[model samples]
Each structure stands twice: as structure tokens, then as C-alpha cells.
Target: MALRTFLLLLLLLAAALLITQAQGIGSSASDCCLKHSQKAIPSGVVTSYRLQGPESGCLLDAVVFTTKRNRKICASPTDGTIQKLMQHLDKKAKNDKNKKKGQTQRPRGRAKKQRRQQV
Candidate 1:
């Protein structure tokens, strides 16, 4: 009976620890964008973007565009210009990925060829 009681207490302790960790994770994320920008940003400067919403731990819905210089700019999700930019970025990313996949073999340098000939 004593061993059974000890085992029950251990289980309860484990349950409590799991609950605490789960709650900690809920508030661990930092808010990215405070508000959306009204000014139009050029698609040429934007490299990529990510959608931010309340579900992602943010207060407002936004399109967070990352520029070529590594700057994050927030824009309204409903904006038509922003949507076009997102589509452009998506296509550019797909093309870039395809180009990388096509390059299967790399040409060896002259130094490497000379080393093999000497051996």
C-alpha cells in the first residue's frame, strides 16, 4: 500500500511539471510587429515575407516583408499591393530553388587537377 501511494505522488508531481511547462510556452513568444505600415514598399526591395496574425501570437494581421538589406517591414494583409508583392516573392523563391537543384555537379579547380596528375 505504501509503495502504491508513493507511485501516485510521483505521477502527480510529473503532471504538475508538464502543466507548468505548457503554460510557460504560451507566453514565451515575442511580439514582432506593433502596427502595420500604410506606406507602399517596392517589391523590388523585398526579398521575402511571412504572414503574421493573432494565431501566431501577434495582436494584428500583417505581412512582414524582409528586405534585401535584412530589414523587416510590416504591411496590411488586406492591401492589394502587398498581396502582389507576396506573389512575386513566392515566384522568385521557386525559381531560385529550381536553379540550385539543377546544379548537381561542380567543376573542379585547376589546382585539384594538377595535384591528381602529380600523384
Candidate 2:
């Protein structure tokens, strides 16, 4: 009789825990917001965006753009919308550097008749 009573008690405890966990999940599904964007994407109106999952949540740290046609684009910004714009500008700089590197320029000093092998 004592063994049966102990087993019943354990079952009740497990049921209670399961009920509480279900309620918690329901509340989170309704309350949590993820991947929020702003109407005026160019004016820098949006704030923070994050991705929520079963294990953890992480901040996007960028500006997300939405067009009238409902197209989505992600812009890089470590902090805010302006920062994302800065990131784009930095990318332009890198591209310019790459273009300059690829161009053929006259050598200042005596050079080999053959061009160096490119990797």
C-alpha cells in the first residue's frame, strides 16, 4: 500500500509540472515579438530586432528594409540604422580598393617582361 501511494504522489507532481510548462509556452507564443521593422526604413526609425528560439535569443544588430513591393533587405549596422549606412559606405571603400588593385599600372622601376603569376 505504501509503494502504491508513493507512485501516485510522483505522478501528480509530474502532471503539475507539465501543466505549468504548457501555460508558460502559451504566454510566450502570444507575447514575444521577433524581427520587427519600421515603416520609414530610410529615416532610421527602427530600434532593436532579435531572433528568439528554444535555446537562446540574439540581437540582429542591423537595419532591415522593406519596400512597397514587400521585399526584404538586411543592412549591416553594429549599433543603429545610421551605423548600418556606415557599414555600407565602408563596403564601398573596400570595393574601390579591390578595383584599384585589379587595374594595370605602369611600374616605377625596371620590371620583368612577364607579369607576376596571380594566385
Candidate lDDT scores, in order, read 0.84, 0.55
lDDT of candidate 1 over 51-83, digit per residue (tens): 888787778788899988999999998988888
lDDT, model 2, position 6: 100
TM-score winner? 1
> Model 2's lDDT to the true fold?
0.55
Candidate 1: pairs in clash: none
> Which tens-of-lDDT digit does each residue in 1-119 have in candidate 2?
99999999999999998998777654444433345444335534332333344433334444444444555545543447546555565575688889898677765778768878999
lDDT of 2 at 75: 51
**Residue 76 shift from truth in candidate 2, angstroms:** 12
Stretches > 4 Å off in candidate 2 = 25-31, 41-54, 57-119
Clashes (candidate 1): 0
How big is the positional error of residue 15 in model 1, measured in Å on the Cα after superposition?
Answer: 17
